[model samples]
Target: MQNDWEWFNNNPEIKKLMQHTATQGYYFILYYMYYVSSASSVYAGLAFGAPIMDMILPLNETREKIPSFPTNYGIDGEKYFILLGIHGFIVNAMAMAWLWTTDAFIIMMVYHCSSLFNIVGVLLQQLNMKNCNYDEQYEKKIITEAIIVHKYAIEFAEFIEKSVTKVYGFIFMVNMIMMSITGFYAVLNFEKRKSEAIRMALFTVSQGIHLFLNTIPSQCIINSSESVFHAVYNCKWDELSIKSKNLLNIMLTRSSRPYTLTAGKFYPVNFENFGNIIKTSLSYLTVLNSMQ
Candidate 1:
């Protein structure tokens, strides 16, 4: 067991990725883009993300840059502090990348599920409408191929999402609980030391904001997955199958929110309750639209 552990610990590829993501574990959290996250696996194996990016189009385009701690300083204490700071960022980057992979997979699975059910329903309905003697092999073949693609996509997406969600949830819970203890202590100490309370609040609030934003995509995935079944019941029989497939794909792939999380760069969140930051702006837009 010791030798096995030593082998893994010494492995270059294994050491390249983060073992876990913790708030106190690392010092800074990078705004990890989804595609960048999945590409980490590729990087860990092949040292590049180009080939993987060809297959996935992650909605997040915000490239968050982190300033690393300077390792060149001469003093031992300064070097130690710099090393610690840089380690935190390295851990944060790995965690953020995993979080992103989960988000992208969740979105893709939902789209495929939605398309699958709608196509299935349409095909079944068509089967019922056709005469027993009429030839339906070509139509059935096309529909079967489409359903296979969707089913596999949905399965693959959901599997990846669930695995990542569970891992992230555990990491998040640990961070919150640890911070909460610190926060409680800080609140008590607030009477004597205001700065400590402020510092604790900053960290706690940042975690809260990150967790809440993370949950949004998960909920959206659930909503998208259910939509697949909804498409089945609302089929139009007279439409050509290929044309219908294209329309259904578009409808299924589209998320309810036109402005993705990345759009927040334009709207800017300077408030509590992360969702409300977007909600307030959306409400204003609604009113503007009503006036127009």
Candidate 2:
């Protein structure tokens, strides 16, 4: 009736005929939409990637071992591999828990894991930058070892990226398109369409972006395939005269392979815009949190 009065006051035609029923009529739509999008399978897809792996690699192999390793990074490559296996197992177990139940406990575990990953990833990234010796020493380490290290990383990144796009991306794309049409009806029926929380509306899209962003670093580090150098490093000590080591060093030091040996083996770590993208995302999340 108030809507009818408002109509009567504002527009002479329908003002007396009908009040705007839209606002009060269609409010439930938005609430339902929020619940469906934010709480469903969309969140699960993005959470599956491993953060501990990102931090584990450099910390264990580079920081933990050779002489005086830091508490954070692994001391030696062997310890690093072990930690990698353990972290990987934990992530897998969490995944298994999700398949069985969407229990709050499971979701919390995922959230905690992702947080830990983010923290460790950032620290490992900084630690790697500090450890100049890693590169210099890797320059001395066997080419075969270097190739395996690079392969393990690249395969891991590719697998995670592919899974994300294939699974979550598809689900949310349908959800978003459907919701958009629903939104159109919603706007048409309501006199004053209360804006759906923009942050909530874009929740599915954000997960897609998050997956792409997290995968970038792993992709970047794996783009090297120095294989001939692999053979040089694989040479038996008995087969290696000191002269051979000298020759091998010269060959490997100067030689490098583009990860796939194809023209476009893109490395996210090397990408000029990588760091800025991360900062921009964190900034956006901060702004959203403040708005809430």
What digit string (tens of lDDT, one per residue) describes model 1 on residues 1-292?
A: 1332354366443323212212211222234353344433322322112223434744355222212322444555332543454455566577766665665555444333333333334443543354554354544564565456446535644454545545555644455455555456446657765645555555455555555655554444444445444544354434436655554555446422221222222321122334563354335434544553
Give each prediction's root-mean-square deviation over alpha carbons: 18.5, 31.1
List candidate 1 stretches off by more than 4 Å: 1-142, 237-292
Q: How much does candidate 2 score in TM-score?
A: 0.26
Compare the candidates by TM-score and give the number of the best one. 1
The alpha-carbon deviation from the true structure for residue 12 of candidate 2, after best TM-score superposition, in angstroms, is 78
Give the CA lDDT, 0 to 100, for residue 124 in model 1.
38
lDDT (0 to 1) per candidate = 0.44, 0.36
Best by lDDT: 1
The 10 consecutive residues of candidate 2 with the worst lDDT sum are 62-71
